[model samples]
Target: MSAQDSVPTPAATAPIDPIPTTSTPDINAAPHDPEDPETGEIEDPDNESSRFYGPEPDSNPSDGDSALGDYRSTRSTSVSSYVYDYQYENGRRYHARRYSTEYDLPNDEKESDRLDLQHHLFLLTLSGALHRAPISKNVQEVLDVGTGTGIWAIDFADQYESSKVTGTDLSPIQPAFVPPNCQFYVDNMEEDWTFDHKFDYIHGRMIVVGMRNWERFFQQCYDNLHPGGWVEIQDLNFPLRCDDGTAGPESPPMTWSSLMIEGAAKLGVDLSASNRFRDIMSNVGFEEVTVEHHAWPINSWPKDQNEKEKGMWVLQNVLEGLQGFSMGYYTRGLRWRAEEVDVFLASVRERMKDKRSHVYLPIGVFYARKPMGI
Candidate 1:
């Protein structure tokens, strides 16, 4: 063999990790619902007056294209969202800001990133990747869609040695020393999926932003899953508005979350997608579906020191992960100036991390199961 042949060719053509540059606010033609709150002109709401009945699964598989609602949002991004790259930064070539679904995020939080044990772990366990389905055997033929850094998949691989674990993402940011049983892939889940084997379990977490169709995505999941399989989705609802009963929706806390939501919506991401989770799961023909709510303290102030420290860990993640995740929601939704967003997120981080703040963190998880025998 030639000396060139002796040199091993690259396995997969690694994707570029470019930061998205959509600074221009496309107000008039933006696809997001409602208005830029500050802009004073509102986009048409999705007939909110009409309640969402469950998504009809068996009707026409292709019908999902029309039946699914559009709530995706993507806005500004920052350093934290991609901070994992700093630790596992290999191919930071693509600055696309974010990648398609089929990615996985690990539970491998750093000592600096450690959050609450009861809350964050519970939030993660209910996410469909870790927990077993009441209907199916331990999740076999598992697929972690959008596995960021392949964290969840790696954990799943460690837990179920017999089961094959595949974590896929649009970006090639997974670590090199993954479990022998765990595998990673670079694929765009927003488009058609071409996998031959159906999965027993499909877990999608924190995929509210940058997603457009809910029905189609769930239907695709149903199609990709084996008979009687279970699919679980863990996502936040509208960023929680602090309710002291006197604070109106326009209060600082409410507006803070709102600005985050609005900007992400402009980018085809749905910051307020939790309300639709059940509707989409039912539409995809999933039966015995259920939703669970978990409260994530934006800052750690829960009266307990241990809980407080946990909150700090999550707060740090919020600080860093924002760049990778919600910065788009805040920056684009609120039309926040860079300095303004930086300052706000920084303060939120500091408060959350403050050992004395004592705040508890929370996020919601939604799960559903496909009925057995068709």
Candidate 2:
């Protein structure tokens, strides 16, 4: 790496809290309002949040369920400002909680996006797009699909002052105030996109399930790029790495995986498509492609000291986020009892803190450049 090259270290990671700013709300700032670190109170402006911790409504905080709700999806296509659905694809039923941002927690999903070290690292990796791929200053337009927290795009706009960065999402949960160079629009990228300028760089991350058509998405990116533009995607496989088989089938970790993997499959999304990263890029007509795979030990698989520490931290975040990822869908999507989801989340939490296990997580990072000349 050159002096200008900065590999994202664990320290550079964004926090799981809502986005905050030094003087004012960052263009996409969404900080949590719980236990305001500044005031030490439970409910303050800082405590106002979309993501919370508790087992059930008005339940104890440790239960953690109290702080959470069903998955929140906002789309312009819906007739109702908010629609609750208990039925998912393939006729599966899961409880789902639906509310409009106009009423419910708005722009608070940043709590979910920057939830932990792994996710923070993921955002850092997205920031790497600036270094890994080069786009022109004259190439003023950029798009960040599934722009969770709008962190990456905000940073991009901060770095490339001359460029305009637009972050699009199905839910307008991104932070509000952003750099003048950056802005956000609410749209389902899966549908047709109406934008004027071709982009210089297009980024999509952790959108594995939301994406139904990888090839088409890539093609869209390719078509929307300025001849030599680039696209970067970051995602990881599920069922994680049980290299030693120490994390058995009956393990909470495994049970958690079973619930997510099966349900996502039922919904027609492939959560385990990490290896397809390159294939999708190639199929989209992108050239000079490259992939970097990393070892992510789930719940600290190694006896090695450092790996164990980071692994455990990663596991803890997964356990916490799983509720919003699936139960929010199941409760909001399938209508499963809050009790059942609570127990499931509890079990996942137990396994995360459980130190007597071996685990690994595999991730794929792929980027490709469109040919500049032809």
Candidate 3:
């Protein structure tokens, strides 16, 4: 059967199982003494502990309050009204809100559901943790940038009941029944932020399309974070890779990815910016930056049972949602007719089913901490 024919129909409601944290070692945990690795004890290399660790929060709580006030005053404009002026091309809808031209993605109910599906796929890939950042239990505030369907924020709120989670996106298509501590805002992250409070943790996933200025965006994230707060950025790398050279420069998948990237570049959206996130975060005054790269196989091509299963899900995600991802970019940015886009994607789908093609997309997770005294 064809890849599209084999694609599993997603259920109406897919349960997001909380990822177990025990399997993955916490990277933010106190480091072991360099002198003695056996004990796993934290020993200060420098005699001055406060200088390296940072001032205790209780020592000067007023500084945090003042910092928050400064950030709030910088961008305190009232929230804009939620607008859903959707544009349709070849039966697929694209968002017509602010930065609409730049986004090149749909925001209708169907697309929202696909985004939620993508969220679950990411969760499965990351082993269930919302992020790789070592967020403290005492965190009181959190922000989710480009929270597609607000699923991450909802899951975060459910995970940390004490923390107030605010999810911002260009579309106001988030569900109504969110956690009590979670709220959705119709806003764009590329614009200047006007948050009233500082966040202990800020999470942004798959937001490369909406961000034109990575430096300015990371700087904004730095400004809005409480001292020592964490920001985690997770994104996918495109132009899918094939290990054995079956899917190569001439392959349909590569052709599709190249076309998409070319189209996105014309719209001023850098789809390949995920690779440079580490440098961007560091230049923005973030400290202790960490990056982890994971792979999502294109189909059930892996010999390992776990990877084979994951690949199946990834295949379904790409096959089912390829049209939603391609329509706007092809029509608006590439100036291609909608019918041509569909025909090209159909060929790409067939190429994906070839077992000889061991293709996978790199999933990069970058987490950084805002320096306490930068």
By lDDT, the best candidate is 3
What's the best-to-worst order under TM-score? Answer: 3, 2, 1
Off by over 4 Å in 3: 1-83, 99-101
lDDT of 2 by residue, 1-374 (tens): 01122122111232223334522111121121323331111221221221112111111112221112222222111112223333342222222323121111112332333332334444322322333455566657788887655666776798888889877765444454568888765555665655666788887767775676777778788888888888877666565555455578888777767667676665656677755666677777899787654445545444433333344445555654555566544554355686787777787677755555555555555678999874
Question: What is the full ranking by lDDT, best candidate first?
Answer: 3, 2, 1
TM-score of each: 0.64, 0.67, 0.77
Go through the candidates in order and give the clash count of each: 51, 42, 2
lDDT of 1 at 94: 30
Q: Quote the positional error of residue 8 for candidate 3 in Å.
A: 34
**Which numbered prediction scores highest in TM-score against the true structure?**
3
For all candidates in order, the CA lDDT equals 0.49, 0.53, 0.66
The local distance difference test score of model 2 is: 0.53
Which residue runs of candidate 2 sit more than 4 Å off their true CA positions?
1-119, 123-131, 134-139, 300-309, 328-335
TM-score, prediction 3: 0.77
